[model samples]
Target: MKYIWFLPLSLLMLASCDDHLLGTTESAPCVRQPPLTYENFGLPMIEKNCAGCHSSLHAGIDRSNAPVGVDFDTWDGILLWADRIHVRTYEDLTMPPTGGLTEVELDDFDEWMRCEVFPNAERF
Candidate 1:
């Protein structure tokens, strides 16, 4: 009887020790954030997000060479319309018409607008 009780007690102690060794824990892979740049954020995002409806040969909304009413094909044109884009897409979330971009991508765009796109605005 003593040995039988000892075995059960030892098993319980071992289980408790195992639980302590494997305490609550979490692990997530580190995500390497891509560098924000014109090629990465500006060109690709615009091409994917806006070019379909705002490209050239589409009348007043073309975004290609002629850029319809708001040309974003050139650096100068992009600089000119940066504020409008920001307002429509970021502030109001009305552009794109399909789905909105992720907050990270939006932040990248906002940073780009503040740094490269709108700083050299002729009106500003």
Candidate 2:
């Protein structure tokens, strides 16, 4: 029947109007991205990603440790090696020694290298 064809077409049109099908469900709760200060973002990321081998006590012991004179446990130490860290981690994509950095973490590192410096930030 002619009306039967309309039933299938109407059903198809109704399905397309459904919010779920259109990806229009209720909004996700908003989450503020955490600040990227050293205390908030930098320290935790380095401790999680870089410290296992780059810390003073672990350098000589961990097979993946940074070479001698490189330590990441302290802010001063990180500043000292910041350039090399920038190059190795971002430019060469050859740090962390295990799992790779996520795009989020890499963005944070790029911001830190470009925009951040401590109150007593060292020269050279």
The candidate scoring highest on TM-score is 2
lDDT of 2 by residue, 7-36 (tens): 889989888772211211332222335545
Best by lDDT: 2
Positional deviation of 20 in candidate 1, in angstroms? 57
Residue 13: error of model 2 in Å?
A: 66
TM for candidate 2 is 0.63
Question: How close is every model to the real structure, measured as TM-score?
Answer: 0.57, 0.63
Which residue pairs clash in candidate 2?
Answer: none
Q: How accurate is candidate 1 locally (lDDT)?
A: 0.61
RMSD, one per candidate, in order: 18.5, 15.7
